[model samples]
Target chain A: MDKKRKYPYFIENPLEHDRVRRFLDIFSAILETSNYRYILDLYSRVTMKCSRCASECQIYQATNDPKDIPCHRTSILLKIYKRHFTLGGWLKAKFTGGSGLTEKDIDEMLESYWNCTGCGRCVLYCPLGIDHRIILRLGRYILSEMGIVPKNLLVSTREQLQGETHNSSKVPLKALQNTVEFLEEEIEEIKGVKVKYPIDVYDAEYIFFTPVSDYLVEPDTLMGIACVLHEANISWTIGGTNCDGVNYGLFYSDSILGDVNRSLISELRRLRAKKILIGECGHAYRAIKDFLPTYNDGEKIEVVSIMELTLQLIEEGKIQLDKNVIKEKITYHDPCNIVRQNRGIEEPRKIIRSFINDFVELKSHGQYGLCCGGGGGTVAVDETNPYRMNVAGKMKAEEIKASGADIIITPCANCKKQIGELIQFNKLPMRHAGLHDLIFEAIIMKDGKKHGTDD
Target chain B: MAQMIDFFMKPFFIFSVSVMILGLLRLFIKTIIEIRRVIKTAGDKDFKYTKIFMATLSWIIPGKNTVNTAVVYSIVSFVFHIGLILVPVFLMEHIIIWKGAFGFGWPALGKQAADVLTVITILSGIILLGYRLFSKQRRKLSSVHDYLFLILILVIFISGYFLPKTYSPFNVQVNMLIHIVCGNLILIILPFTRLAHCILYPLLRLASAVAWHFPPNAGKELNKLLYGEENKKI
Candidate 1:
């Protein structure tokens, strides 16, 4: 007899009976009423056993586990969809029995889908053109409905949704005001130029939105934005309501994703801001720039990534850079959401080229770039960090090592955190900086002096 | 004996073809309606149709994104798919049968070409089956239905090849009957199984483009219907 592998999250501390029952009830109901029936139908009938997708998958490359294959991961959900929702499945259950959704199935779905980063890299290489990312999102939505999401994502999203701070980090108005004030003082001290971090300035040309991570952890990235915008003299203000651009819903729940996006739209209307300016976060840019038009109706608001703005500013000579300031070999870590999913492959490279003299490409760069192994909220969950370092992060760490770049420029916050951790874990002598971090360091201030030196 | 073969063969062929046509049509219409629904309500209004077509065209041609990574598998798969249609439609033996049924036949490939293409089809089927069985990931993803479809195709190819040339101890006529029966069964079942990829691939690819732009609030209407009215409005 073959020994069956155990999944602890499902089997060891199984969901309470009532919760499982409630989940089953709601899930079964969802099966009937949603477009999932169509999705299930398409998935069950469309996917074949070609195994072409395995060669390109980073997770499978790391673990060598068949289950980590993108197609195989989606297959777990497909099997459940077939068994529970299809006509043949119903008939089989009626006659042969024992093919219904079980607690184990729930566990397996969670394990397989969560392990995936919802990256579209596999889709790019799948012969069938199956968007396994969509299927993974549907899986995440299914799990979120059952209240079976990572506690961190859930808490942060809830705080962003219901809390007074209007952002995931629960940063209140006063805290945000203080952070801005502090950032202004720091900028004045360092650059010898007083720049204001504009907050809720009505009729501003752009309403800037960034991931709360920037506000909480990556303050330097925000400061860089302040310097560029101030030097360019662009009228922009970070929104006060739902100032955080990161929609955790895009990761876990479509409803929450919708809710968060809707909140942003409402904020935009309230601010009467002409355009939405998203900072250097990848998924946040994806959520507003890529996702908002799909979800909302008749919104004429123009959403632009700050990278694009910076590039435009460079072309217009609105900002000047001292290209000799940061003389270190640097490699750019492409965030999957931005580069592959959102067609942002060239913008960052263009910006990077203008500032760095010794830039090198990773073996797998641009559209073919390997993920930093921290996407799709993997960086948010604590339990998966070891896996990130040892298994998923293995290829990425090697890629970084082989590139031989002293500094790694990550435009996305998640990549910064995850790659930052991978650097530490692998004991690699790599430093993490935002793309704007380099720009901030290199840009000549209005006084025609570099930021750190006054000579 | 000939009458019995005719009795079993003609009806089976017609029934299988009818099921193949009708089943595929239903799938096509259902998928179309689903697309229209999504496109009308939830799709990105600014979605580029040219981009969708261009993306589809890129995937269809060799040396594109999908084929660049797994060159061998994609080449073999492309060759096998071409042989799949070519052998069945253009083989001399198949043309004779088509003429007998429809009173018309197109030009057929020479015997040598038919033999080579048949061999390619059979080999591809076997390779696909072997891959499915040997690769732990492929095996895990595959269902019995997936394996059965490959085996059925292999059986058809093998039995069909043997019908014209003698390799079996059994009667050639009996072997021909088995080949015809299996071929018909495949036609009947293809649209229902994962082999539906054969017919549904193009539409699904386009649908994926639409789905890529599928709205975040696309499920909002469904949520109301499923969970009852709760005002977590998007």
Candidate 2:
């Protein structure tokens, strides 16, 4: 095979081609002049070279490859920084003329940076507290700008940004409304109660934002959320436009992330919603609750997680649960963005314990929980599944299998899809559930009827 | 040759001092300014000084956190760093040199204690170097500067250790010159190389968001900026 064709994920010998080189030069200049000052400071710091992060990285632990170590993985980009950005690097280039990045170096970065799930477990153990995940994100931004992103992420993000539906799945408002109506009818038939999956209700207190996939892939969580809101009598509505809370730019591109987030804010403003109630999608929750406030200042809308709402409702006695509905040994998978990144660690577990009698804890749980191997958009990228399973997901699978749990509950949509697939691929006995799914099962609705009873 | 060595001694000492002070000042001012600018525009105004102090202190002390995960390497590194500081600050010979140069000196460590510390420092440097070379993981991350810095420190220690004894294998004056030059070179490059960690570690703890644990509002600001929260309207 030609060396040019070796690394298909990245553009070949970027500096060798005029168009690619121009893009690199322009992007490099942008980074040099833009909001990347903090990142530049971070990369310029001396790596203590302790290899402390290797033991903490699941990828390195599984592969035993030094190159997979987070610091080593990041050092590839640091080397580029040193060669292009620093004074010593400049002097070395002046004297030796041997410090410029080559095509081979670009290829290596593409291979290493994408292999990481941006799970950020390494940040916990690093003595200097380097966030290697940011470097991976920066790498993704640069790569995405060069049109070298994974096919799935590129397609989804593009569709979400520029498509007619303004969602990655391209589910139109009609389809979304139809799905919500279907769930409403299904819930009514099962529980002998009528609930509204309200769409674009003006002046609602809460504007509910969730991934479009919730309307297609799994609606159990959606129904659970509807039941909780109905019982609590909260005025919430999903917007007709920009209902997607997912900002894929969180995974790959800053521009896309900004555009997607801004659009969501516009929708919220249009609906005249007072607060943004993000559903049980981890990255979506993070993008809205954490990233939204930063991106859209002066938008005084208070954004919060659904767990906070459910927990608050349960505490107020507005939401009641049977508690005995779930009897199997169940474990919870803490989504990286929620637990470590957003501090939703306890709330999700609290909601689960309300319904589950036999809750088994995975050995690695909470802030240090192993990633579901599908974080940072890896779940969306099909090109890396073999690596995700055999390497990134290995420790997580072993942890799940060892817990001997019959069901695993995760609040994050990405984790739901990733862990569900992992169970199928690894042949584990456990099935995956959303926290809302279990909550849907156990929560006592106000109409004095259980699910599956025809009126 | 002795005259030449004596002639260069004053200038070399002055040069090393100037380089060390100026280089460190530049690094410190730049880092502080950058941090302040970032915080003013994008980060939380309130900083948890106590948290920063504790986090820096925890990392400075030996056997706190590193002991749990990296036992052997942490122990060796801690011993080496402790000895490296103790010998330089307390050794009688170094104090005597300081007294001669600056007319100020402190009480020095006993000769026997200095000897033991010197040996420990030398051994630790060797062990650390060996670890870097032999451990495939570390070796992959190791660069030319890593090895060169280790070699420089070892030479400084080795030459200083023999400077007190009547060694005949090589010219004593030459050995003295090698020790002086290597030590001076280290001072000149200290701010430029990974050795800057010796000074910047604590500052990074205070200034960098990753290293600080702040109040809730501060955390929100930090999350907004570092996590792309500030890019949107709050």
Candidate 3:
């Protein structure tokens, strides 16, 4: 029998002190006086009672504790703001429930803030219309500055930043080159084409950034991009360095998280792509769609999600998709980061509908979509805490079962992995497919012949 | 009679009115300035319409929704506000006083309608207060200050409804005076409490609309800023 597993609560870990300190330092630096004041003012004005916000919070509902409410989490940061900044706080801190900050406060803040996946469901329901998730991010930023980040996540983020890829596999240039060569050969053998996987092509109109999974386990998704780009006859190239777009740094704090994005942006400028297309990764899309604009100082390079681009190509008659390419009855899982956080519900559906004839919809598809439970770098850590993962994935698993679709197609790499694990754990019949795989299968070649074989 | 008249003629009344007007004017100016800032920051053209529509609707909608579920409470609250406005300005007694003070006399709604509105407003206010205590979601969000304000409103509304007639041994004139004073106090506190949402809601909606449109991204050199480093990687 498999050994009983323990939940990997960061507080319970032996290396908690070192991890906590590092997180605290990073968090403090980011929440310097100016940023703190600005965030405090935003939080102050955003406090309002809305039942809609309460209705949307799954964690709060699951726990049945108002403390678990997103607004209550916001209140933790708001209390600090009250104590340090607000005038009302100066007059009656006790009455307002504001008090002197302590180490215990820091510990609780770390635990609660990290618990949130930053899915942004509350932003949809806020009546006064606050992005509670952004406030939580600010809390994460402060925590990260203090060196209080969770160990497993922090280690992965450090590796990704240092190695330029999240996987311990540490895909180097040689591996990447070999993988591309292998993909090219596979396509030639499978689809009868000698198409090139251009590396560092100068001044391409599009610079495609994808998660490392596509290069390793899911070559078909990359080939799908290749097939679509070929059919559209679009000028695009992949970067030789920092080719992986998935940014785990975003899960930690903005400053650390921002480096990967900044690098991607700077690379896009050098290549001079009219548009930068992000691959089928949820957090990568969220970073680009939501966070990138905030940091952007006036750079206007169009950054489009691959699903969005696929839809655009279909609309412009650049690619004709064969519906029968994916014969299995399929349902789409809208990754929380992409759907709720980025508000990218329609484009992916359009792409799916265009490519597959029997595409079914999950009940919680758009703003209400369940998290794959592996977001915010949960998938990367060893599955030491299986119960947390299972409990988190409960909603998603139930929805998948209810859908009765033979295949679950998610445009996000993280979602694909999480759902795959969930399916395996539950002994479900559903198999997982990336959105790009279907797109690849359906693409008609330049010679008016379908690229992918039925097998 | 002479002493009572002197009490009625005290400068406190004039001071209160002046202060209220000043506060209203200050709030109006501040609201306008903030709205302009939002409009200026709005990046997209679509936000312009959204801001305008939200600002307009905030004033038009009264009592959270049109069909008030808490009927008695809604009636009481609505009446209290209408009475607070009408009894001070349009009632024959106030009109005479106003004409003496400012040489202006305006058309007034009939006493029956005025009475009905006042009762409805006061009743609604009370029901809402009760709802706040009983409702789970509302109770969760409510702080002590929220409960205090609700009780305060309940007192003012209930007192205004029963003054000089049902429960008070005080003279009708004295009771009415007490009701007016307490009602005004509530108004003064309105700006500081959750009641301030009335004024802040439209402004916030406008800001959201503008922020949504102008999204710090439109028309700027996003490509250059985003892709500058990517070229090196390429």
Candidate 4:
């Protein structure tokens, strides 16, 4: 119980009494009432046992277990859906005594669904285009309904939605003010420029939200973001009232995903901002951008990744880079969430290639890249760090090593954290950073001072 | 047996083929309704159907963007599907039956090509089944239905191949009965079983696009239903 005290969870509450019954009840309700039924119904019927997804799954490659096979793992739930919900399955069960949901299936699900990472590479290779990632998420969402979730993710989600501070990391508004002040001074000292992280400026063209943890731990990324935005003269503010963009809901529950976005969008509405900019968080960006189409009728504000904004600024000649600041060999790690969504892929690569002189690509990059193993809320689990490094993250780690790059520029907070863990545990000499972290180094002021040798 | 085959063939084909067409139509209509409901309920209906259409084509075509290891299997599946559909519709015997019944028929495959296609269909169908039975991973995912379905298709193809010959171990009538009966059974089960994938595959893609989507306030509604109040966290 003496784990990360930053987050709190009611793990014991889910398994309190008659859990199997509760699980089945929730599962049945979710299937019937929730929108997942259509997908589950369709995928359950069409999903093949061909093991095609195995070729693309990093988890399967490492463990070489049949259970690790994406389709096989997905089949576990699909079989249950058929056995319990569909007419054919019901007939078969009545005649043949087919199995139903049980404690053993629950145990396997608890282990398998969480470990999936939901990187979604396998979905692309699915012959039927059955993105089992969604199905796995459906499984997790059902488990979440039973209150079965990783403690850290649930705690963080709880805090974001209802904690003392309106952020996942539980950082108070006072701390954000202090971090901004500290970064303001740090920017003046480091870049010889006066950059401000404007707060609560209503009617600004853009409002920015980054992972609250990055606000505290990744000061360099914040500084790069601040300096770039300041130089670009883009009207933006960080809403101290609701300052985090990390949505763990996207990994587990649709309802939570919607609820969290509703809260964020409310902040945007409150500010009366025309556009919302997300910083260095793929799922957060996806939560707002991709999920918005399904959440609303595309009526409201525009959502853009900081990478997209930065790429635009670079193209418009609003931001200048020194290109020589990054001498180390560099590769970009495409976060599964960003690339899979197909929105944030090209921007980060373009931005990295613009200034990174010694840039290299991973063995598999773009939409086909391996996962950092911290996807699907796995990084928040913490106890599974070893497994992530060895099995889940192994393919990405090996690819990074083989790329022989000294630095891996990860554009998403989750990938940065997960790949950081991969490097730490794998004992790889290389380090990883957000694209903005390098942007902080290579950014030269437009029509202002260069990072001159005199300093 | 000849009398039975004659008596049943016309009505059986009519009934089963009608069921197949209407069943797939029902599935299609249901899919569109579900997609619209999910979107309309969510309040976000701005999906790019054009892009989805293009993407559907990519994966629907075997060997396009396939994983290196799955290339052979995908190609084999492609071949099996081609022969499965082509031989049934284009065989001279089938066209002759169609002409006899409807008083008109389209072009038919030459005997040599039809024989070759039938032989390949049976062979590839076996390989596909072999793939499922051989791998522990695949076998674990397989069900009795999976095995039975492939075996059923192989039976149809093998019997169809023997039907064209003048002589066989059990005579051509035995193969004729199997080809007719097995083909009818497939048509009957096509929509009920995973065999529906032949038509449902594209809708499977659209379902994936639209299905996991959340209706606005989806979480709030579920929470209130379960606990009488939406919690701070789900």
Candidate 5:
């Protein structure tokens, strides 16, 4: 039999200090220090609890568990806020059996908040414009402060923030250099020309940061990025230490999110790059693009996502694609961070459509697109694979199955991983890849020098 | 007894309405102060006023841009709000009361239309209360306050509906007093409870806009405050 599990099976809480008191203190500190209280104050009042979000929540839909309902999950925190923070709730509980913050409630949040992919699809359905993910993040942030973070997330973030390699993945300077050279070689083999993979080239126009995992696992994406940048004449550089764009901080801690983005921006300012160019990761783009300004000293350091840049390059006729290069029917998966938050709805689709004849749309596309379920850093947590594959992953799996496409092209690294996992778990026939992965396959090499011309 | 009831009606009505408006004003002022605070402190200060305004409008009128994802409840809730606001302010007798007290009244709603709206409000309130009560999901999120507020509104509506009917068990003065007092009671407590959603709902999106705008070095500040100098804790 599997060993009887202890409490907090989801995240690693050291239990060294008083967890309950730490939770309340952190919760109080957040309200006192930031504008977070304003949102909570308004949110605690405006929530209608109509169960409208249930119809849209994929996890809730698959599990058929009310606990999975975004409103219900959000209420776990909102209830605590009402009881402890607000006057009405305090009076009610004082007189009529109201309760305080409990260890059990924290456990419920530990279990529930991560279950959401932070999709914000439910925001579209909600009449009040309440983004459940914002509440979800607040819940996750408080828990992380209480030292109740998924070991996978906490470990990786700890490694990135404190370790010698200075990245979530412990890719050393030598390994990053090796990854760059490897991508250069792959680009040369694929395009019959040397694609520019610049490193520490001072005063470059842009600085590139992809998910560090992409450096290890996604050579084609790095190669594709190089080829596109080379063809577009966009000079870019990558810093060694802070090159990782994957911010798992967005999933849990605001401080970590800020620190990660701050580390990247520190690199950009050091390298004197015009803007930070993020590679194919959903939350990475959102973390940097959306939160960087807040995290940094109120300077909206410009961000150009690889997808947006590629689309710009394509739209400007700087680089062209040969549609005949790809034969499979392809469908696009809109990463929630990209579509719902960043409003990057059609940039990838427009790029894909320009290059493929058999481009298919899923049953629900764009802002209404479902989550890959492996979001919120759930992909990193080894214990959640079953939940990611079965509960949250099923809707997206069914969508891909229904689309009848041979390949799914999502520009998000997280979505690609989740979709990859879904296919393996469900024994599906289709393939999943990043948008850049397809671009590398289909991008016409420089000026009629075909991939095989010099081979 | 008539003079005492009249005295109770005028003074209590004036007091409740004043408290309701001032309370809402105070909260709204807090929201504005929050906006200014976020401007000074938050990361991104750009406010998408057009998008927020349009989105707010869509929710205000369900036939607009809400896109009907929660088709049944939203539409029902919209119908519910219609009479919940309109019938009290626009009904002829209510206007007559206002005119009697304040020496001015606007055009009153037709009696037939007012009754129709009143019944619709009561029915939809029942549906909403049922929606809250029956769903185990909803019940878990609800408070006794939520239940009591709904029942209070229902009481006021039921009493208002029965006010004109002479076949009632209670005398006319008794029925009128119940309607008057319950209406004032809701107004008095409106800002303190979730019912303050009435004033805060339209301005809701702005709070989110402000929340995402974090103060400069907020993370570091919070961590330092929580865990001493170094990033020692977690």
Candidate 6:
């Protein structure tokens, strides 16, 4: 294939082209100024070459390509940073091989930045203790300003910023009321308890928030949280208008990330709940748990992961689990956002352990857990880069095969869909379940009734 | 003879005094402040132990590159730095002045140990430079500054070795003048280059040690912080 034609493969839409142009313009301005020179000087003086960092890169090991090395990525950006930005680089550009940035440099950057998972695994391994994740994030920030982000990600983020929901399946005020009514009926039939799936309940002790995807695609997980909360007689209510827990701006851009977080924070504060319970979504949890703390400027608020809260209730004997609800041998896949990035390693495992008798841990658990391939909005971009879902899913498939478990229990929705598709595509004889599905199944009724099989 | 002694001793005494003052400033004042900043921010508890272990092992062992590459470079950097130090302080002529000034005297390692150590350190420095070129990983990450640093060290080491053992051609005065000027230039450049890592490493380790033990916030406080209790969406 011709190299010019190869460039088209990366640019899927005109918006991307425009965004790239905008980014180049801004960078061009920076390059023409003394500020750029100062930045280059600081960066050059601070950045160092370390030989011990070679073994730590996962992308390098996976691809066996030297270009995939974490330091190589830094070098690419650093070279551009030096060339147009420094006096030495300017002088050497004439004699040395240091050519300044062109349109091609931006294209290469777009491809490179998107490939990084921002896992911080390399940061852990770097002997110099450099945070390469910061470099990737800075690249993303520049890309965002250029408006060259992936289209599907951009649309969803725009929707989230406007409607407070990424999915069109959002439960608006009436739908939310109807769903609560429907859930109440289901609760009466199953648990034989009269519980209110209260909406906009003032002075509630807890405001239970979940992704809109849960209301449409996986109601069982949402219902599971409700059933557990109802059984424990905890005072909780779902938000009436902004029921979705997702923050799409976390992926699309950085400039809007603060605003996206502020919008979410405003909704949470409006509810006046003593505590906020985030549902079993990986990226959502990360946005709230990790990113929010950095952007929110030390704002004090109570945000607890649903898995953590469930484990707490089980440990306190506030809720009892009937083990027979899940009789199959189960293995847990730690979502990358929760386990590796946010250090939420044990909470999900504790919840799974409490309910499942035949639980087996995957070989690469906790900090070393592989990504579900659908993370960072890759799963949402079905129309573009569809192969990323499967290509990245390869490691996950191998991990599951090695576990020898019949069922895979993970806490994140994206992981569920990604792993579920992998199972279907590979024809693996294993089913996937959300952690809440098992938890809800194991919840004993108020009248002492147990559901599922008696093994 | 008196004129020659005065000419040699004046510059030697000035440069040596300057170096000693700078070393004292780095060791006593600047190092303490940097260490304090590192300790204040480090989240890990084991960082203190790791920092000491890595620093000590850097000199004792040969190729164990841990958190700080500067430590390894500094060890082999002895050729350039020690030659720079001793050529001013403990040279046969300078020792005579120290005895005159302080009324103190001691056994010096003499020229043999000095020459041997200088050769060993210089060879090690060259090996490190060569390693950067041959190692694909290092070469890819290396900047112009890195290459420049390696060349600078090579110049200092090679020139010092070739300069007259006693008095010789190339005008000992001119050679000594070049050595003093270049040595001072490197001293000024040290704090700004990757050489700054030598000062930053201990502090980084201390910070890492202290950062490890930070408490996991209670879910209640975290929940409020993450999703404000007032607005109910996220």
Q: Give native contacts recovered, as a fraction, per prediction.
A: 0.59, 0.25, 0.10, 0.72, 0.71, 0.13
Global lDDT of each model?
0.79, 0.77, 0.63, 0.81, 0.81, 0.61
lDDT of 3 by residue, A180-295 (tens): 99988877666666677888887898888888767887887888887777768788888776676777656655444455666777777777666778988888887666556444
Query: After superposition, which runs of candidate 1 have C-alpha atoms over 4 Å from their true positions?
Result: A1-15, A18-20, B7-9, B166-170, B212-234
Docking level for model 4: medium
Task: Report the Cα interface RMSD of each model, rounded to 1 decimal.
Answer: 3.2, 7.7, 8.1, 2.1, 2.1, 10.7
lDDT of 6 by residue, B1-234 (tens): 445445444555456546645754564355456445433432222233655456444543444443233455445544445554554455554466566655675666577766675576567767777767887767766766787876776665555555656644566556555554555556656664566554455444333333222222211222244344422232
Model 3 chain A: weakest 10-residue lDDT segment is A27-36
TM-score on B-chain, cand. 2: 0.84
Candidate 1, overall lDDT?
0.79
lDDT measured at residue B8 in model 1 versus the true structure, 0 to 100? 45
- Local accuracy of candidate 5 as per-residue lDDT tens digits, B1-234: 577568657877778878999998988888778778777777777778888777778778656444456666677788888889999989998888777767899998898999899999999999989988897767766777879988999999989998898787778888888888888899899987777778887777766666777776777778778877535544
Off by over 4 Å in 4: A1-12, A293-298, A446-449, A452-455, B66-69, B101-104, B167-170, B231-234
Error of 6 at A75 (Å): 3.3
Candidate 1 vs candidate 6: the DockQ winner is 1
Q: Which regions of candidate 6 deviate over 4 angstroms?
A: A1-21, A24-43, A49-54, A84-98, A164-196, A291-298, A383-391, A453-455, B1-139, B143-188, B201-234
Deviating ranges (above 4 Å) for candidate 2: A1-16, A298-300, A450-455, B1-11, B40-57, B62-64, B90-92, B103-117, B161-176, B205-234
Model 4 chain B, poorest ten-residue lDDT window?
A: B60-69
Q: Compared with the true structure, what per-residue lDDT tens digits does model 6 show for residues A1-455?
A: 22332321233343434443466555554333212222233334456655444464445555655666776776666677667656767888978776577667777777667665555556544544555655565566556545556655666555665554433344467766777788777766766666677788877887766677777677667777887887787888777656666765555433344555565666667887777778988877877665554344455567788888888888888888887777899999888778754367888877788778898988767875767666666666564344544455666777788888999988887788888887887788999988887776778866634463232
Write the residue-wise lDDT of candidate 3 on B36-110 in tens digits. 654454332333465456534643456343122234433444445555556445655446555665567788767
> Taking the candidates in order, what DockQ does each have?
0.52, 0.25, 0.16, 0.63, 0.62, 0.13
Candidate 3 lDDT score at position A62 = 57
Better of 3 and 6 by TM-score: 3
Worst 10 residues of 5 chain A by lDDT: A1-10
What fraction of the native alpha-carbon contacts across the interface, defined at 8 angstroms, is recovered by model 2? 0.25
What does candidate 1's lDDT look like per residue over A1-455, in tens digits? 32444442222233455554655666576565445666667877888856687888888888888778888777777777777667887887889985566667677777887787776788878777788888888887777776667777777887888777878888888988898899888878778888988777888899989988787788788888888999999999888776898788888666777778888988878888899999988889888887787666756578898999998999899998888888999999888888875477888888889888999999998877888987888788877888788877789999999999999998998899999999999999879899988887787788545655655
